[model samples]
Target: MANFPLNRRQLIGGMTAGALAPAVLRAHSRGSAGRAVVVGAGVFGVWTAKALMDAGLHVTLMDANGPANARASSAGESRMTRGAYGPDEIYTRMALASLSDWKALSVSAELPLFHAHGVLFFFHEEIDYFRQSLEVHHRLGLPTEELTPEQMAARYPMIDYDGVAVGLFEPEFGAIMARRSVQTLVAQMVLGGLDYRRGKASPLTMPRGPSPLGAVRLDDGSQIEGDIMVYALGPWMPQGFPDILDRKIVTSRQEVFFFAPPAGSDDFSPAKMPGWADFDAGGLHYGFPDLEARGAKICFDNHGPEVDPDTNPRQVTKEGLAEIIAYRDRRFPKLRGAPLLETRVCQYENSSNGDYLIDRHPGYTNVTMVGAGSGHGFKMGPEVGRLAARVALGEDLGEPRFTLATKGTTQARSVI
Candidate 1:
């Protein structure tokens, strides 16, 4: 996940839970209903396919590398979940609703996927973001606490509050096991009779004007025709529609590191230390406590250099490792020389303005292009799927911000 500095203008500029309820019914019969073909089995695509299937449509989900693959953005150890978007209430609401669904999923799963460890935000000089988010949280009735530096230290003694001015703690917000959750959701959908295929799909032909597509070509030279099609290819969105999305949706490399805490110490556990984001010196540094015995995970929430997801080498740069190590030592004195246990390299498919692009292609009216996660998309998977399904079904659920018309050629991210 990527987080960037928000200026006053950026902070100023930048949903129903029942409507997103998952219908987990076994596929019995779809009498004359149309077939919906969804390409890319990432978080968004998987949920979109599920929503479409539940809408009484015969749905087919296709992916080249399978769900939660190593290269997929949705394939990660964990992701933070919080309803704080610095005044962006739409995302806040969606995240809140998504957390509800995630809790439900975890309750029914064999192993818990959602970890309710809570999340904290450390606000430094620029407190406008935190203040605005606090207002929204209060209005939404989210259980959040405004804590001073002294209170934060008293609450979380393991973390150093050197430059922190204040803190916002969200008790209900937490982390979700990324890879396992996505895989589990997809597997459950498959067990419920979702037509899943392992193959690469592309537009058979570039149809002119706003016309329905004929078929989507596969790597095996076969074509899958459907009444409606959805392309939620994440980083591959540019490759899928180079003429349009090549510049609109950019893919950037992101690095994450996990360090082993001290032995025989429970202070670094999720129960002792909640997931935290530091906004000191106008930078975003975030991490989670040791979860499921995985080392304390940390990542700098800034977009890295652009990279081709398919070809980029998934190696953490030496500078990145050193930087994270220094940050770890400064924030957690006990882990001054913690050994690195694991590392991951992922790509965030970002839109021009850090908002999602979910709308029908002008040329392919029946085909919906859903992507541009912009780093903070994982937690909104369920709602994104619900909105995508509604759009693919020809419903005019209007939201100007998410439309393709708002996308630009150059990136000027306003949403965090």
Candidate 2:
């Protein structure tokens, strides 16, 4: 799927009319009519609601957290939007489709949801992983260019490419404003007459003969019945659905730190400093341009200790800050002495296989499950939501890819 420009009117139509509080309530009430209950208002849930509304279904979106709260994973500032799948062609295809949907949704929501500043994968020497990434990009026909160390330094002078041998640059890959995207999707859902509810859903109460459908009991014993239920709950997967409790979906806490860019560095802005990932260190180290001008946001890919989403501390610790600082000093010499401005933690609801689990509940047809996005799932949330909606609508989703079922397994609880 190629990227298509969004229409101007659609872009303007995505803005919210009133205050966010009332608009969310109104959206929830308006969408409660026809009979679709989408649990979880994270990025996936919001987009799922929008997609359902577009398909003419009265969609009700539910989440345990309050509106636009940072409790969930989608509350982060930015998420990478890259189609260079690094040997996962299926994901690449999905990313291509997702890019198209993201553009359309962005226009409809009237927001600059995407920032196509591109991604630069750095390495000290040519390795098999780089070769695989290059092959995947070539196979997908994505616009990926190989750069020599000198070429990369010349083009992206901000990077410290002292010992770098080669770089892979994907011009179309960039970042997405995750929170804005979710809020915009919810706003558009409201504009399109979708309902947004704030609560946790209990097990479904249904008739005996047919598949389990209708009426999700809330935590407060209140029950809201709908024809279809879409479980887009992120890390709350095990909390909501007990059947998967025994499944291995480990929740881990990860932190990203923001640093003040060096003075007089023109390339520190989003337009000049693209998202970067270095695979040379045997651990994933990535960074994004800070939107607040505090500094470039950077973090390691290593998983933190398992945490319960409800009570675990979401604040970064001094030790975590030290690790990030050490990374800067070791690899990014130019940013060695940068001042740390802020740090925040986010949860990763990862599966055992490191793949997403988007499928109909094995025991129930009316209940659709979309979760365990693992760490890499956010980059593909829009498309995942679309696929989840399709499943909820009783449409054939074709073959599963980047999913747990692909390996003939129902769930792999923890990948990290």
Candidate 3:
């Protein structure tokens, strides 16, 4: 574990490198006598504050909404949780390491955070991606098994395997109760004595002092000051920090639909269903068990339109719903034409490189910027939170997990 505790000098240099406003320096000085302030009370923000508090730092978590607010992605009912990553070896390792932390937190919070129901990758024909995924899992010592179409149909009768060529199963894979996890984390933060504030944070003036002095100006012009700041504002970051707008992060709007399975298709129930991802279609097809009474959930992976995060997320169009229904009809005939119960639109703050950005601000050492979720960040939220906390504390990041592309190397293409 690389732990880099930020000293006064390093903090100043980091802030300068990121070209942050001078107020950032004054607000984050270690010499300041105050608690650490985490902006945005989403999963990342709350967990970051909790980590800091556990490390003996007084924490003040400020967010625009209350816990599990719909404005944040962390409010989703569930997120697919799996560890059989293909070429992304680093992410697989991070997930494995995070399991312990998640389990510990689940126990402490007395909440069921994970469901080890396994995951099934259904593919048509012998695809290279599937082969590569199986190879990678084997090479990484992960438990995985291949199934023939007959075997798959026998095991998962709900799946229409008429044209399916192969299936890959990872018994260790599962799903996470995302909203519950967020609630648990927030509860732990409160239990640990972290202060909570609800308000929008704008740039604020810093008090004149030699010590670190930062203030978050709220909507009412009231300022909340702190010794150090953690910028976990998620998609709202672009408005708060405009300097890095062009450097790569952008918000994309995605929608998920829930539908009632066809009558007699109880096999799709949570007790028997595992998460499924299909690449046989032109695009990625992913779905999760609907454990929150919202019906079986399904969505296209990385095929959403770009949008501004501040706008309402309820603009899902009739065309979008049609596309989803068509997908279900073609790939999952059982759920085809099922009654649509609900739809959820969420924003993904993506990086051009398709990897997470968990580092100190180039110009502001005292402030750490956490964004670029890249669509697949929810599963690793706790690990990313831990890493963000370590960065804020000035701890050295150990071996990099995923292959993070720098601005110089990343091309001007969509992350998907």
TM-score of each: 0.92, 0.85, 0.83
- Candidate lDDT scores, in order, read 0.84, 0.72, 0.69
At residue 230, candidate 2 shows an lDDT of 82
Give lDDT tens digits, candidate 2, residues 1-416: 34334342322222232312222334457764356788888877777677667655677888888544688888878888776555566566566667766766656666577777888988878877688778977765677899998888788887787667888998877888788888777876677677777887775433445466547778798977777778877877777666544355677899989888878875678888889988765577888976646578898887788888888797898888888888787766678788888788988877766767777776566777887777777777766777776666665556565344553334343232
Q: Which candidate achieves the best lDDT against the true structure?
A: 1
- How far in Å is the alpha carbon of 125 misplaced in model 3? 4.4
Q: Please give the distance, in angstroms, between residue 344's alpha carbon in candidate 1 and its true position after superposition.
A: 0.7
Cα lDDT of model 3 by residue, 1-416, tens digit = 12224232332222122332234334346453246788888777877787677656678888887766887767778787666566666666556556556666656766567767778988877777677778767765667889898888787777677567888887776777777888777877687688888888875232243344356668888987665678887777667667554546677788888888776657777678878888675677788775645688888876377677767567578988888888888767778668988888987777766677776665554677776677777777766776777677666565343223353233343332
lDDT of 2 at 50: 73
lDDT of 1: 0.84
Give the clash total for candidate 3. Answer: 21
Clashing residue pairs in candidate 1 are: none
Better of 1 and 2 by TM-score: 1
